[model samples]
Target: MTISGSCFCGAVTYKIEGKLRDARSCHCSMCRKAFSAQASAYALVEQSEFRWLSGEKLLTNYESKHGAGLQFCSKCGSTLCGTYKGMIHGVTLGCVDGNPDIALDRHIFVGSKALWETVPEGVPQYEELPPENA
Candidate 1:
């Protein structure tokens, strides 16, 4: 399935040629600050399947000391996607143009989550990452 998304101002657009997986909401402080939200909802995609569709020059990136790279639109400051060591890590679900047929299957880092942020019932929660085999 091909997925499309863009920044708020349409300054940066992207296409993912394959399906997304490992959907999750990250509640760690770094994620909260990176997304400017209580948490960040995202799904991982292969770098080979991801590409910029337009306005690539308008994308500004920031790489954390831990090597997590985030891409934002310089025009609207919208968080578009995440990276690791210059490779595509995942796309922010909020930026997707339409429903991506996926939902957060895991709520991670609840131990470091904001006190006011309550994860809804039924979704799996973890203080950190789930067991690698989970």
Candidate 2:
């Protein structure tokens, strides 16, 4: 299956081929700040299956730290996606155009979660990153 998405102003667009992994909500402080929400939802896609469909030049990359960077649309400042070590590509759930046939898998970085925010019921919650097998 192919799933497409774009930034708020349509300045940046992307296409993901094949199946997307189950989504996860991240409660890390950086994620909260980047998304301006209690958490950020994302689905990981294999590097080879992800492609920039348009506005590649309008996408500005902010390297938050070593080996990781967030890509957003320069025109509207929409957080489009992120790259980790240039391997796995993480697509923001909000920017997706339609259903991506995926479900929430778990929540991570709960230790940094906002005090007023409560995790959704029944979803697995982890203080930090989940185990490799999770």
Candidate 3:
């Protein structure tokens, strides 16, 4: 399915084609701090299939020493997505419009999750990366 999304201030926009892959929630500290939420939900899209539709100049990026790149809107500073090691690009699920009809398949880094939160029922939870690396 094709999906489109924009940042909080509409300073960044994009279109993604093909099937969304590796939908999951990240409870890692970096993700939690970057999103300022209990957890961050994302779907992996190939770098080639991800296209910036507008306001490209308003986008700013920060790279972690570990090779994870966080892209956000310069205007509102909303975290849009993260690109890791130039191989996989993860689009923040909350930034996508209209729900996108995709359910998060699992929760990763559950060990780092906030103490007050509970994993959703029936959704597989992993203290670390899944065995299949999904």
In terms of TM-score, the best-performing candidate is 1
TM-scores of the models, in the order given: 0.95, 0.93, 0.92
User: What are the clash counts of all predictions, listed in order?
Assistant: 0, 0, 0
Cα lDDT tens digits, model 3, 3-100, are 89999888789888866787999998888888888899998888888888998898888888999878889999978888886444889888897767
How well is each residue in 1-134 modelled by candidate 2, as lDDT tens digits?
Answer: 99999999887889988878869999999899988999999988888998988999998777755676788889999998878765547899899989999998999999899999999889998999898735
lDDT of 1 by residue, 1-134 (tens): 98999999987999999999999999999999988899999999989999999999998989988798899999999999999988889999999999798888999989999999888889999998898834
Candidate that would win on lDDT: 1
> To one decimal, what is the Cα RMSD in angstroms of model 2 from the true structure?
1.6
Write down the worst ten-residue block by lDDT for model 2: 80-89
Candidates sorted by TM-score, best first = 1, 2, 3
What lDDT is reached at residue 52 by model 1?
96
What is the lDDT of every predicted structure here?
A: 0.91, 0.87, 0.85
lDDT of 3 at 80: 83
In model 3, the Cα lDDT at residue 59 comes to 81
TM-score of 1: 0.95
When sorted by lDDT, best at the front, the candidate numbers are: 1, 2, 3
Cα deviation at 103, candidate 3, in Å, is 0.8
